[model samples]
Target: MKIGLLPLGRPTFDVPFAEEKLAAMLAALDATGHEIVGPRELLFDEAATRAAMAGLARAGIDQLLILQVTFTDASMAVAAAAGFDQPLSIWAVPEPRLGGRLRLNAFCGLNLASHALGLNGRAFSWLYADPGDDIAGDLKALLAGERPAGRLDAVPVATRSPDGARVAEALRGQKIARIGEHPVGFDTCAYTPEAVQALAGVSVDALALDDLFDTARTVPAEAAAEVRRAAEADVTGLDAVNQEELDRSLRLKAALETIRESGSYNAFAIRCWPETFTQYGGAVCGPTAMLGEGQVPCACEADVYGALTQLVLLEAAQAPVFLTDLVDMDAADNTGVVWHCGQAPISMRDDTAEATATVHTNRKQPLLYQFPLKPGPVTFLRISQAFGAPKMILSFGEMLRRPMAFTGTSGVVRFERPAGAVLADIIACGLEHHMALAYGDHRATLRAVAAELGLPLLEI
Candidate 1:
């Protein structure tokens, strides 16, 4: 079979690592004896992607294979599906858990592509493996147009929770202040206002990223100092990072407080990324963690549904909730790693380790929370649009005490079921990458909430 390969990536991640992985992946594909066509270089932007796609179309390959070299938005993946008539396949390589920065977060790119393609009603096969792994059989299966099937555990029968009605009522008339649009190609963060309002009675207030920046600049020096003092008490090593950036990061907390009070917001969905570092001269991870610890949930990447999921879990658990990404899963160990760039609440920090102030691994910006999550029973929830409809996703797990798997806030979780099974279900269902996690068992309350909302409960 002839394969047209398009390698995708972003500059925000480790480019050298991605390039190395790309070389090995290319070698693996070449060893498959399939005729390969298209550029060997990574496509970092739309113009390059479009040029490559056009060349591949003219090549008339038997299949279009997207080499997910790093974590990127799903825009180009969807574009490829829309433009090509050939069978589509995605292959993402895994990086080692070195207790450092996450290099080549290719699986997340695959996850985003899967959700976007599924949402667009496109059929595609996928593979997750290291470049040197024995995946010749998987490659053959992909060429044969085989897709992985996902399993759905039977929905738990709803039991009455005394606080279910109160929680439901509280959810109504609540507003989420969404600051800035979700990043380009992040369909996982996309939301329909009508769908959101109809399901949760929650209204969304969209605010500009500039608004937060401007407000942060005008924060009174005394107020920013007060925030700094509060942060210094709980988080250690603040003085080690860039002082100017740390001050700016603390001011962001005050700005968020001002916005929350003025808007009467119950939660925030913020686009915490390039602009925060490039344009605003600060990172929001630390401030987001602070708000979450204070019982105000903040979802990174402007994920409105993620914020809503956090609110539901917070109400159900009566504790802080963290929005995290499922970055790694190992069936052999029966565990998976959940992580984000460092916005986990301090309240969730493992007592064995002090929560430390840090910088973004890639951006080198100050004010990120660095610590592993506390070990205990944890419940994961997501308000999902996977498979083209809104549903309630619930999963049970135990947070294991372990060394930091990667930079930022992360934890190794052993699921109630096999880790491999959970991974299969997630990919098969095309579930969103983001899940709201709260320590303790709130499955019963979540079931009642799902029942009240008339949503299909999918437990993986």
Candidate 2:
């Protein structure tokens, strides 16, 4: 990627020193294979800044990294660049002094520049570093267009759409496991294993439920006790079939451990299928949910690609994450319903389950859930393809605080466009309707991966 570094204004101190710092920053960036535009001054005067921006735009640069805002008065130049709507990153550096009384007030100027850029409603990233730390990675990652900060930087975006078709195609060579068979004859959750292999280049392996059972049988008594305690605290009716459910759930965890121990799979999808429903006569949501949270990608749809997508996302971020279906949607208030067999990992919960989660064990049957979800802020996202394009839907807000309360929380999301319009833009390009929902904002890194894999992106 070619990055245009336009010096917004003249230096407040020595011009040569300013040039030297800019050169150092560029040199660091150059190592990463990104072409830097220059020490070119966009504005010696405010008016000149506007002219420089036009020139940069005409030159067709991918992004801009604004430098030395206090120097060379170019407020107009920054404003003009912002007008173009190119991705921007505002760099603020602390003055160099060997721990000598901390002289220059770098923050004051950076704050002013950030505010000016903010007025235009532009999204940008900020970094504070001296000559030492590796800032080029940050710059390239941003120029490539991913969130450059926080845990979200690691979340992966998988595409089965045209935008990411090549990526999905490349992914085909990879191997993954989907534990247990699809619920006997439940078709809704059925998947075409042949279609998955043909389309995604993935080799699928079906695991035995006995593996999970064996692991559960051998679990340390303490672990089983913890499971029971968690269940007792969170689920209702301990006497109403608590032991039965706990035994099954613990066994499921043990099975997951066995799968992990084998090391034959890069990722996994398990059927907490409905037989556990008829036989145990309770639910298996907690165990399956826990498996996903533990880092295995468990898909309720018995979808190989879906599990792979979740696995990719999980690899990007090491934090606890949930894999769920968009079970309900309310356009009236912009609220949606999301539920599954409740087998998501317990780590994904910031708090305890509000109520018990249940499901029939059929892998092909719709998961039945009755628990109120844990509460906290959440960022919802989906990565799927349409007409061959890879697209995403990312939004953030607090999960409903009250227990399974008020039919779930809903609100209007603020963005450059509406969800339908965004969806339209994505589908018009031919992306997939399937998406992997994550619980955090991962726009930046996901975008970067999309670009690397040659997929078009939508940022709503």
> What clash count goes with each model?
0, 52
Over the full model, what C-alpha lDDT does candidate 1 score relative to the true structure? Answer: 0.89
- Using all chains and alpha carbons, the TM-scores for the candidates as numbered come to 0.97, 0.47
Task: Provide the lDDT at 305 for model 1.
Answer: 96
Where model 2 places Cα greater than 4 Å from the true spot, the runs are: 1-175, 181-203, 209-242, 264-266, 279-282, 344-377, 381-435, 458-460
Poorest lDDT segment (10 consecutive residues) of candidate 2: 405-414
For model 2, residues 1-460, the per-residue Cα lDDT tens digits are 6676766544334455555665666566667787677445424555565566667787787777766533222254346545666667655454432211112233333433443333333456555445456566665565676633211111344543342333444464666677677543222233556755654456788767556555666777777777666555544554544455556665555556557667556566655544455443334456555556556666653555567666545544445556554322322334433434345455444354444433232232222234445555555544443222234444444445333421211112222344334322322222222345455555455454455544444554
Which candidate leads in lDDT?
A: 1
Off by over 4 Å in 1: 149-160
- Residue pairs clashing in model 1 are none
